[model samples]
Target: MTSRTFAAFLQRSLEELKEQGLYNTIEPLEGPNGPTIAIRGRELVNLSSNNYLGLATDERLVEAAVRAARTWGAGSGAVRTINGTLRLHEELEEKLAAFKGTEAAVSFPSGFACNMAAISAVMGPGDAILSDELNHASIIDGIRLTKSTTIRYRHSDMDDLRAKAREARDSGKYEKIMVVTDGVFSMDGDVAKLPDIVDIADAHDLIVYVDDAHGSGVLGGGAGTAKHFGLSDKIDLQIGTLSKAVGVVGGYVAGSRELVDWLKARSRPFLFSTALPPAAVGASIAAIELLQESRELQERLWRNAAYLQQGLRELGFSVGATETPITPCMIGNEETTQLFSRRLYEEGVYAKAIVFPTVPRGTGRVRNMPSAAHTTELLDAALAAYAKVGRELRLIP
Candidate 1:
């Protein structure tokens, strides 16, 4: 018999998830996460990675990382509050501010930690946050960390936000009020109505926060979602990741100099967590510079997305409303969604199925992320595999 410990609860919980068909099996890629990846010796069209600009394996980024690693060592020696603050990190932050069009920026080890550090640093028990219903898990967790009251508005519903904001402000039960949202919903790929959101925030005198983890390097001509909507100057905080489109690993909060300075003094992550490796910082700087210099990569990403979207629609598969490179082929049943993903893998496409909890129940889908590196032939191959699997499962006629 197994020994009594926390293992029982954990084991039972995992078992329940598997029984409910919610347990996911992770597939380890044999090589870099590029437009094409090898799994068990088979090369497949990789539509599962967040490397939107294909910089993860870019030669320039690789060279920059190698140079930094050679020059700065493999890891940061300490946390930012200590001696871990390196020159490369400072330069990266500078470029980050420029790219996001902010007065200053502060970097974190990851996007999740950035949210945790930034959100909790600003608000507390007496304050309230008006968050979007569809914000990322990181934001939700961050809100939970603070002793603040959270009021969730309907996703992209400006009227709902207005109502919530007014209620929070008039109740006089809170000292500060802020609104937070994902600039682009990762699941459905729909953009947030930032102009309307900004308008509501202005009218209610609420601080505005945007987590543009999926929008940077994909929108605003590669600046970000706030810039895409021409409201960068109006947003109180603009959070973004260096991992997804930048093809590196880090996160940042871009805002006014005073806000950044406050975070530098108050954020727990920056105070306690180790700084990002010099390689990541260097590569991110290079990636942002590249993005600023050219729109070619962004154009390629959009073209690839359009091609796949059109192909899926023509094949009778229901591709959900996506305004970006993320394509969600909806399959309402959970088990079938998992099976569809597996069949697609067998046919040489590597899109993953997202089900309950990640998305609402009865809205399972295979979330495909097309990248700039995908050749036309590779995309065509992916379309063919999707058609084969979708038809085999009777998901499409």
Candidate 2:
């Protein structure tokens, strides 16, 4: 395409998004992303962060990062295949494996990269992937990159998944079949039926892959969704991100030692990308150790979620069906969802609205992420704001 053609296409697409109320205006946080954050110098109750256990601002992790920076310097220096894999990286992987209840684990620069690397490493042209319709974007892109046959089933519909899996297996056109899903749907805050998924996998001899980015530090006493259902060993691939609950940046894939070995030997990201910095590696190690040592933070996170959810429900706002701390206020339609989020901001709440392409159209919502760092008093303030804005907009009684 010509430069002028590309420029006009970009401008037209952005304009279309803006007109449709789908273009998001990202709010910059002026301070640490904690229970309350300073946005544009105004402090607001932060309900948009993914710091489930509130470990992002933990002093222990900070100190660990500092010590690591002082001892190991700023970066890992080269790609993992070219001497970038440090003792720090190995230690982090080992700790991650123990935390996830897997035999071995491999790390990547980001959670998104982990999906791409993990999927492509094991799947190819003749293979097929039975994906949940609501799987993350990275997973979809990973499947596309593999040039494999992709079959999408309804979100968490066990019957649909079972039919699709059986059909794919019986087709005999594919060498291998994989059933992949998100342990916790980020937008809906609902968990996948892992028990049902596993049964289907076993019936068809399909490989199971679960991307538990939002579940790793929030479910199963902080062990994750698979363990929440006691199917950790039955799962073939368990993917996670250190950036969210772990309060650092990076991603990982955990499973049998052979799986990890294959990833180390064949995954492109592991071979081509630079390793995580010493600070991130150290902080992640600290985060996992903290999760293993105590359940205090996870408990607080649930309490906060329940409190906020009850408040929303009492105010007649629909919080989605979520077993985890991710509380979403369902306000149908793009315009209202966007307006509601703006009002929430004006009322000193930091909940962000999620709309189409992220979730199905007309099911837009203001997704709230409660954390352990939030106090009752702060949560009360947020609830008050939600009530006020909801009533003013006739979103609730």
1-397 per-residue lDDT for model 1 (tens digits): 4766778988999999888779999878899999999988999899999999999999999999999999999999999878999988899999999999999999999999999999999999999999999899999999999989999999888889989898998898988999999999999999999999889888888999999999999999999999999999999999999999999998999999999999999999999999999898888888999999999999999999999899999999887888888899999888889899989889888999999999999999999999999999998999999888877888888
Q: lDDT per prediction?
A: 0.93, 0.93
- Total backbone clashes of candidate 1, pairs 3 or more residues apart or in separate chains: 0
Q: In model 1, which runs have C-alpha deviations exceeding 4 angstroms?
A: 1-5
* lDDT at 337, model 2: 95
Candidate 2 weakest lDDT stretch, 10 residues: 317-326
TM agreement with the true structure for every prediction: 0.98, 0.98
lDDT of 2 by residue, 142-172 (tens): 8988999999998899999999888988989
- Residue pairs whose backbone atoms clash in candidate 1: none
